[model samples]
Target: MLELEKVTAAYSGSKVLFGVDITANKGEITCLVGRNGVGKSTTMKAIMGLVSTPSGDIKLDGKSIFTLPTYSRAKAGIGYVPQGREIFPQLTVKENILLGMEANPGVKEIPQEIFETFPILKEFLERRGGDLSGGQQQQLAIARAVVSKPKVLILDEPTEGIQPSVIQEIGRVITRLKKDMAILMVEQYLEFVLEVSDRCYVMEKGRISMSGRTDELDKDRLQQLLSM
Candidate 1:
């Protein structure tokens, strides 16, 4: 499980997140939804220690990770698939995934479940990451993250530019992964979020404005918030 309590973050002393609080429990998907520039991505970065959070705490399980470095956070069971996919362009698919094992030095081999979750990656193991399509690259990113068998998985805009079919596949993979780890994501695609998420947190202007069970939230209000 992951919990962000009264987390406030900033860039160059300009505050972004304002006392944000969220919880993602094991075996469930918790989504953060909001329009651009609402600090959604900043929240993820703050959790990962990629940005400075001068106040509040980010806890995995029950201990605070706010003071840990980025790599230390990864080692502590937080897997992050950043918004751009950010795969190493020159590395082969196999090599890229193998790099993920750095988070867990004791784990020498890529997990078998990774291939099962992404069969296409198996066939393209030797192919350069840059050569793969957008969807394949996104899949590769997720594969790289989950290969570490993290306790908490964080995805930023998983469906940003992928085709619809791949989006569905990613959704299914996300849903399945929840049974093994706490899943948290920042997404704007409401349809995909509604279909796969167990809970939703609607953020506005760097703060959580509303939150509730996905199905229990007022759909029209949710839609209206996203539109604005």
Candidate 2:
């Protein structure tokens, strides 16, 4: 589980998140959705310690992790799949996945579940990451993150640039993964978010403006917010 309380973050002295508060509970998917430049990605960055949070607290399982470095946060059970999918282009697929285990040094091999979640990865183990299609690369990114068995998985725009069929597969994978770990995602695709998320938070200008069970939120209103 992850919680951000009154989290105000900035990049180079310009604040982006303003008094943001959100929570991701174990065994559920929590989504943060909003238009561009509204600090959705910054919220994820703040949680990962990739951005500076001058004031506020980030907690994992009730303990504060605001002071932990990015690596420490990953080691502390946060597996992040950044917005761009950021996989190493030159590394072999297996090598890219193996990098995820840097946080869990004791794990000797890629867990079987990773292959189970993504059978395509098994066939592409020796292939260069850059050689894969965008969807395959996205699956590779998710595989790398989940291989570490993170308690809270942060996925930023998992559907971005992915094909429709791949998006459906990713949705299924996300639904399956939520049975084990807390899932927090930043997504602009409303249909995908509604299909997979248990709860939703609508952010506007760096603050959470609306939040509720996914089915309970006003779909038309959400569409309006995203359009603005």
RMSD, one per candidate, in order: 0.8, 0.9
Query: Whose lDDT is greatest here?
Result: 1
Candidate 2 is scored at a TM of: 0.98
> For each predicted model, how many residue pairs clash, with residues at least 3 apart or on different chains?
0, 0
Q: 164, model 2: CA deviation in Å? A: 0.5
lDDT of 2 at 151: 90
Q: Which parts of model 2 have CA positions greater than 4 angstroms off?
A: none
Predicted structure 1, TM vs. truth? 0.98
Candidate-wise lDDT, in order: 0.95, 0.94
- Cα lDDT of model 1 by residue, 33-67, tens digit: 99999999999999999999989999999988889
Give lDDT tens digits, candidate 2, residues 1-228: 899999999999999999999999999999999999999999999999998899999999999999999999999999999999999999999999999988777788889888888999999999999999999999999999988888999999999999999999999998999988999999999999998999999999999999999999999999999995
User: In model 1, which runs have C-alpha deviations exceeding 4 angstroms?
Assistant: none
